[model samples]
Target: MIQMLVTGPKPESVAGRRSIAVLVVILTGQFMTVLDGSIVNVAIAAIRSDLDTGGAALQLIVAGYVIAYAVLLIGGARLGDRFTQRRTFIAGLAAFTLASLACGLAWNEFSLIVFRFGQGVGAAALAPQVMTLIQRTFTGAARARALSIYAAIVSGGLLAGQILGGLIVDADLGGTGWRGVFLVNVPIGIALLMLAPRVLPVTVARTDRTVDGLGLATLTSTVLLLVVPLVLGRELGFPLWSWLCLGAGALGLAVFVLVERAVTRRGRDPLFAPRVLRAPGLLATAVTLLMVMGTFGGWLFVSALHMQSDLGYSALRAGVQFLPMGVTFAAAGLCWQRIPAVAHARMIPFGLVLSAASLGWLAWLSSAGAGIGAAASTAFALFGLGNGLAFSPLMTRALAAVPVTLAADASGLLTTSVQLGTVVGIASIGSVFFELMGTTASSAADAVAVAQLICAGTALVAAASAALAVRRMH
Candidate 1:
């Protein structure tokens, strides 16, 4: 059934009729992108088995999307600033839809991997514009509500993918099975394509904006430095080259900072605003987000694998495992409007403590076993509750200080932190888990214990950082 909301032009406020339409459209895209991230995690083994490919080919499909998505994030925002936000949004939607079709119809494993990367490129153009619209179109209290709604789409995207992947893989959908994962987006994209122009306002850029290609290239190279090692680390026996990639990634990142500072010195808009970085609270929050989301990203990937491979649960069952978290996320997002009015400066630290406690509980569960048993259920729910509160707080606080002129720049910083966190998380902790889990005669028990510990510790460190940043702001 199609869900439709009637909205119009010249609505009294940004969050009035028109903003609703844009939000709906952006949500659909956001859902598709993030869902793709996890939906494939559970199905990787199945995909490899059916396609008769090695783990590397399968991993590229996963890593390819993250890499492409991360690479394109800032550039995507830049495109929105350079061109028409509405045009960029439409073009990105069409490209992503076409790529999804390609992935669904892939005749070979290599084709599937390639198409997924293309889909990610499309997402890069689409995702940033969501924030751009919210920041541009809405204001004051309404803006916070708008931002909260959009944040849910990000989390909803993840849970939806897990559910769909599990259901499709289990259902086999007339033997289409894993292919349904990609096919699901086609209809949503088509709907958005038809409706977008009518509902989304044509917000034009103020002036001629030149893209900082050097910065973009340097940033992309720096990220791949960390991510490549993560997906390939275990398979390659954690060689010296992987270590070099890690070191080089750090160096490239440092170089990227220098390049940005230089660009800002030229009296031009850098890839990210140098001014925004000067806010001590914002910088610390960015660092905390990098660790928080990175650890969570790695945790989701490993959890899906553990559910299917180690526990011998069906894909559908694994999806069910995450249902509680999904439910809480939705509730928390919807209620986020109340946080700023009620919680004030304390919200960030509060959310962090909530998240850290959940991670600690997750550590306990992994130590016991994240199976369908009672012990796992209690701990998982606690973790989900923490996540529900944590996600929006970080996003809200990070961008709170960014002025209207710097909205896009602030958005880019936050998004980049997410990608950087994901790359490092996969490389750092994912490396640790994959390395230990696949080796030794008795690896499963050790891997779970170690991975959970890493997750717990990561969350705690992030919590401490958030607390410190919030306190400083006070």
Candidate 2:
């Protein structure tokens, strides 16, 4: 059946349909993984109340998944390259589904934390394959359209997680409470698992199948050392050990670079190909993505705090307030392709500038005590539109700059930057927000306004980076 589909006459239509199916299945997986990251946020209080979890344990339950996911992402991408994306994706999905079940059934805080980490490991394995499949399966306009949709899903999932989580916890579906958040993945995963093998195309595995054990170990260690501290430092009050780990992480990064170079010189495949980094415009794109995502992460965190803590909004109400932003973001992502291709390169910086402007508007509104009214909602919508315009095009250009052979490496690098940026933004900007709130003179709205200004500044820097990327590429 697979052979016939490949060699069959006038197979373009069939192939197109298959591509759509593949996108649906894999993107469903992507949504599940991405949603899980933020879905637990609204449920934290419920979980803590039910399981008697402490602050530290609760933090772990949240951060552990992210740490494992970020650390193993590149390795997971390599696995797809080595074992074929279809096979690895299935394995990852299966692992994720089972882990979700375990999380739902966890009896204690420790058990739930462990299961959450397992979910992250599975997600690490699962997430990269979505991009890899998109790269390999589609071409030209189709690829652009697919990427736009992918960006929407990635962005929307974050907001949707919070909204859906609030609804689920408030409704207490079947009296499952917080457990419903994790268990929600079960049916979706099973459906995707059944459909994937039929719809997903089989591709030839890479001939250089050898694993780079040293490169993998060093890279994982470096990321673990770096991400662990960033995720935990605020909760732990930035202990001396956290600082030491960060220093060691910096050194470990140097070691990893040296090891990868040595492996490349030996004609052996490194865990991450260094040549991918040398790809024109890639580094600038990475920097742009880092800053853009940082702004987004910070905005989400601080805005939620302002709404809930200062404005006395419920979780669901706060999540619903973000609906305008999500809608505008998805609309912009999908419609960007309609714009002239000649102007697409310029859109990144334009979008960033627009985002910065909107963020500044938000800061002004917050400071003036405008509250969550039409004006504030409009600003949120504008911010979303700007981000939507920037993100998809940035991703398309970055992937286009690299050779198809290094799709895995490019995917790993881009995705890792996004994840790291989110973690760093939350930690750093969140610290500033907390510190300002603690001051006697500052109100919650004041802290949020300051955070928005910082986010606006980050967006402006990202705009500059995007302009630089355009120059390098052209």
Candidate 3:
């Protein structure tokens, strides 16, 4: 028999002294996850050198973590709902810390990749609980504000990771060098692990439900089959295996849908609650994120390439060039709390339009040449504002109506969509840009303009979809 999860929360308000404690714990967990994501990007070369890893192996170092992380997210969230989120969280932290130590002390690329996968496992277990806990703790107004702050900080955390990545590798920190990057997390993880059990609530799961193993297998296969080939395909010139992986990925997804349906027919809560997928509000929210995050990821990848490869900016300089946009994102996140609650969902559609406009303008400006500094300024500010307003609202709105009983599964669904979108975005756009640039007899300025145009087009589609979805919500 499928047991219904016991929806236990301390209090909805989380006001005064008690709620404050929980808030810190929840936000801390979120920051850690966001931080780890981008932190490794800037340090990839350092790791490769220290471990004597090759390009393929180093890519594995990153890809392994990401693939494992993405595959396990739904499973982790379901586990949290089946057990206590608090206990699951504490355990995840402990494992993550230990894994970080293993990563730092590793002697080879193989060990590093394995430990990184372990790290991904820990992150998967820990992440959804952040959303689940926030839902349990706050009411309407407080919840919206907290989500905005969370979104903004998560954005900043990614940017800060690049900065820290540079500083740590350069500082060499007693010649432990790249090792410091992983080692630094150990102490923080220990501290959070210790504090979390004390501050976090142990919401009970009434169900002793086991995970839908068939569903898990099918989903994992779908992601790997799709992402691995796409990431490697262009570089390998789209070999036969690439075509096979694509076909297999599609097949796996088909099977997954069938499996979910079968489990639901048996009167059990499937790997994901089918009911959650049927909610217009929830599904809209997920689709919005799917498009929004894809645009964001595309922008990040293309902009970095244009700035560094075409414009001749130093690596650090290229990163700094993005500072204006990053700062604007941070400011909006901090101030988003002051905005009226009734206006929260409205901001998403508006921001989507603004983002589309910014992308459109930036493409024109880049086409005019890098000397159009003023145009660049305008584009960055607009893009930042749009993203800041849209992302948080999209997340908050999609999550608002999800009952405590279904929180974990729903959160997992969103997380999966977000990551999958990013991977797909990079592959789809990056492939187009690289092919177009290589074959064209155009100047560097023209090539960048082409890439920007692609990004603008994607952003435009995202904006339109978001608007349509929000309209349906009303």
Candidate 4:
């Protein structure tokens, strides 16, 4: 009875025609959200030039969305539990659609930043509900398959952002340039809204009615302190204030843990359930994921810069260079769960090692003065294959130990961590790249080589952590 309850609904009842439509609608919304995250990256130069903003402003445009999404993610998950996943998801999609429209029409940097933040908030509100619905709707093998496809959407969306953004800007549709990226989401969101009500499964809301406001406050504050400083610190030259903010963030994290423990002890629901923290090897998994994603984000930013700024490739041409990675990611994602647990454990380390090796090879190529060519494309494909092989296994390994009741918490935390890692990666490695460049055009190749090496280091660390985590699991 408990197992049935945890699984939510029987496979046949929810995994039918209606459910397929529901999944399509939900994944479409997801593709839009994830697309927004990366699409803006390719458009950053256009956005900056058009808006007459500085580099710092462009960074804010990117980091602002990420910060909002990360901070609100847990709250969004809790809301879905209180309000029902279907309702929460629909509401989120509506807001996201509206936010995307606002982003499209913004006239100034300030307006764009505000709208971008709104889009992030909307994304947060919708993201957790996807995983929650999958939990409630699919069972066993079907659930694994659904999750693999969802992972593909995530990776594909990142690639799409670069590819689609390049195409839209290069095409200059309606003379909108970068605006096309945000505007594209409006129609997609509208389509999802129309389809969702007709197909989504309605599940009962959980009965844990109380929200631990203090826990939420502390957690948000902690994350803000950590993330805000990382985003701005390099631009500000790592002032004393940045160090103070980092210190405060650490203190705030400690306080958040204590506050949540107190809330749980008092028999009130905590912002984060204590049990999720206690899950075996989850901490290691989170750390590994953070490092892996951090490398991924840094690689994206660095490689794009290398292609366009260093190699003088057009945006569209550079974007096309990433197609191989995207293709391999989708293909490998489908086969993610087929590997046995023992093999999966080794796959993480093996994949990361291969990923790092590819990056290192690319770095050597750049240092040797090789431009983007057949050799670089092959290296990129190998990197993509490694990424595809690693991501799903790591995600599955982390969530596998979580109780079904705590799925929402795990989902929110995991997504938040990924976004946070992205911010950190962009800030830290990007700073390294810029510092290496030293305001000289001649240094571009050297800077890119060094940045790729740094990314390889991150991948190696992730591999070490994943290997250690698996060892601990045994």
Index of the highest-TM-score prediction: 4
Question: How are the candidates ranked when ordered by TM-score, highest leading?
Answer: 4, 1, 2, 3
* Predicted candidate 1 versus true structure: per-residue lDDT over 428-447, tens digit per residue: 66567766675432466568
- Give per-model CA RMSD: 5.1, 3.7, 3.4, 2.4
- The 10-residue segment of model 1 with minimum total lDDT is 1-10
What local lDDT score does residue 79 receive in model 2, on the 0 to 100 scale? 86
Off by over 4 Å in 4: 1-13, 338-342, 472-474
Clashing pairs in 2: none
lDDT for 87 (candidate 4): 87
- List per-prediction Cα lDDT, in the order shown: 0.75, 0.82, 0.72, 0.81
Query: Candidate 4 residues 310-341, lDDT tens each?
Result: 67777787788888888888888878676675
**Over the stretch 1-474, how does candidate 3's per-residue lDDT look in tens digits?**
233343434435667777778878777776776667656655665675567765446455655665676788888888877777888788778887899899889888888889988988888888877777777677777877777777877778766765675567677888877777788788889889889978887666646566788888889889889877766677678899999999999999888889999988987767788767865577766777777767766566556555645665544555555667777777776676577868866777778778778877887777667543767877887888888877776677677667755667788888877766665665566555555554322455666667667766766676666666666555
Candidate 2 global TM-score: 0.91
Error of 2 at 79 (Å): 0.3
* C-alpha TM-scores of all predictions: 0.91, 0.91, 0.87, 0.94
Considering every candidate listed, which one attains the maximal lDDT? 2
**In candidate 4, how many Å is residue 273 off?**
1.4
